[model samples]
Target: MNSRQIKLTVSYLSILLISCVSGTHYLFSVYSISIQERLNFSSVQINTIGSACNYGVFLGKPVLGYFVDNYGARRVCFAASILIFAGFSCLALTYEKIFPTSFLLCAFYLFWTGVASSGGAVSFLTTTAKNFSSNRGTAISIPLALLGLSAFIYSQINMHFFDDTFHFLLFIAFTAGLCMSFGSLFLVVIPAPQHVSDTIESGSNDSISRDDQRIEQTPLLNKNNSNTINRDQIELDIGGWQLLRNKDAISMILILVFFAGTGLMYINNVGIIIESLYHASATPHSDAKIKNLLGFHVSLISICSCIGRILIGPLSDIAKNYFDLSRICSLLFAGVWLFCGNLLALLWVHDIDQLWIVSTCIGLGFGVLYGVAPTTCSEYFGSRHFGFNWLVFKSLNLM
Candidate 1:
């Protein structure tokens, strides 16, 4: 392979590995019951950590993505690896009762994981999208899909490697740190060549419709051509806060909030959902049965999510390019699908046995929501300022 192609390959592989760490938030479901019992915390208390982690992720992303834009991916990723180690280490210490303030220390763990995810994810997504401008959807889908699988990866690790929950925390800290540190080294954001702008301006007039011209709207690339002209065709018309004021931007932020909120509810409560639904008490409920069921449910969600992320991105890209689909329209369809999934979860949840179907639907829907966001953001706001703009728009999820 040529040097640029090799760099792109390394970019993809690095993002995939680090993306594994980004989904550490999902592990709350698998490990929560164990953490609750050992730490003597209430269900509400443990669930709060999940919420805290979610909150921290959104809070950190805007800054982290912007930093990746202005500074560089490597420096932020290095810090991210350290945060993962420190966060998990603190969780290990807190569980051992070594920390004086247990709740505060636990909150720190949540923040650490949250911050780490943003750090890793921003770099991964931005790098991949830039490297493969032609197949932007397919490019990002690889990492995003693997990120969804991260929970499953860690669940397997927890089950096989450590009998004790505390030790598993340490393992997570070490493994995540090592992966992030190493992965960061190879993440290089190849700059868009300077002549790309002149090429797009000259080539785009025929394809852009009248309405698109009036609004200064442009497709993500030269849709009629085989090779992409993303950098040149970018919407320099609006960016930063100005783009946020646009209707598309506002709508996207709201949709993501709803989408992410729905997923978070199910994910944070998976342990309780299983216990209450299946009646998995310590005595009456078989521990083996509980573990098996819990792991199974997490895996089902992870697999569906992974597959959905892989599929929806490229599919949406095709519809947008080939069919002249509006970016917002494509997203709304995904949002509708997500809403339908949640509706089905409410309707069919007569028993725990039915929960898998519900989780599957939710996973697919969430995959669509997430996969669309960055690609859409890059298309809508322009990749030139994508990292900061995307992080800003995505902060609505935090709200």
Candidate 2:
């Protein structure tokens, strides 16, 4: 391969590796029971720990996105490695009884895991979105698919390789740490070729069809410094209060908050749901069997989610490019899928055997929503401010 091809290859690989490890929070359901039994913790405390991780993921993003957008991703990624190692290591030590089992402390440790994951994700995703503006859908979807599969990868490793929760936690700690550390070397935004930049500038502002531009009505000014708006590519970058004030941006944020909140509610609590169903079932099963079933569901969710993320991107691109359909159409489809999942969970899925239907639907819906949301944000607000803009939507999931 030529030098440009080599750099692109290395950059994509590095981001994929980083994204794969960044989503350790998704493994919570797989390990939640083990942590509870080993730590002698109450259910509330366990839930608190899980909530801490989820909160960190959302809350940390805006700050991380700001830094990544302003200062570049390498330093943010390196810092993420340290936080991941420290947070997971401390949790592992606590699980092993090497450290005192304090509920608050445990929650605190897991919070950092969320923060690190957010930082790493923003770093790589920002790079990808900025680097591949023309093919953002396919390029961003690949790393996102790996990220969604993170739980599956780790869960399978735990089931086959490690018997102890301590070892499992340690495995995650070192593996995620090393991946982020290594990725920092090559995960960077490449400057688009001048010709490509010129084309994008002319095409985005001038050639956009009325139907294709669903989000922004007119160009927005940079509230902080009016001169910062790129005159060459009008409407390509808008940040701060101005973007937030736009009706389109507000609508997208609300939609994301609803979708992401529902998805996270199910994702974070699927373990408890599985255990409850197991207990209610007339057919008796061993604790080990129940544990295995939970792991299976987690893996199933991860697999379906990965598929959805990967599938939705190209499909959305096709819908927009060929059919001239709005990208928002994909969002509506995902919303309907999510609604069906919830409806199924409510009316049916009383039995353990029937749970997979809900898991599949929920996972696929969740993944598709996330996959399309970021791409939509970039298209609407412009890729230059995408790091901060997308994270703003992501962080609103906490609401």
Q: Least lDDT summed over 10 consecutive residues: which range in candidate 1?
A: 209-218
lDDT of 2 by residue, 1-399 (tens): 777667888899999999899889998998888899888999999999999999889899989989998999999999999999999999999998899899788999999999999999999889888777545677788888899999999999988888888988998999999999999999877776666567556656665663234324322222453222232244457777888899889998888878777888888999999988988999786878877887898999999889999998888877766565777888888888788889999999889899999999989998898788888888778877788888888998788
Can you give the TM-score per candidate against the true fold? 0.89, 0.91
The TM-score of candidate 2 is: 0.91
Q: Write the per-residue lDDT of candidate 1 for residues 31-88, one digit (tens) a residue.
A: 7787777788877787777788877778888888888888988888889999989988
- Candidate 2: 10-residue stretch with minimal lDDT: 225-234
Instruction: State the C-alpha lDDT per candidate.
Output: 0.77, 0.84
Error of 2 at 33 (Å): 0.9
Candidate 1 lands at a TM-score of 0.89
Q: How many angstroms is residue 270 displaced in model 2 relative to the true structure, after the best TM-score fit?
A: 0.9
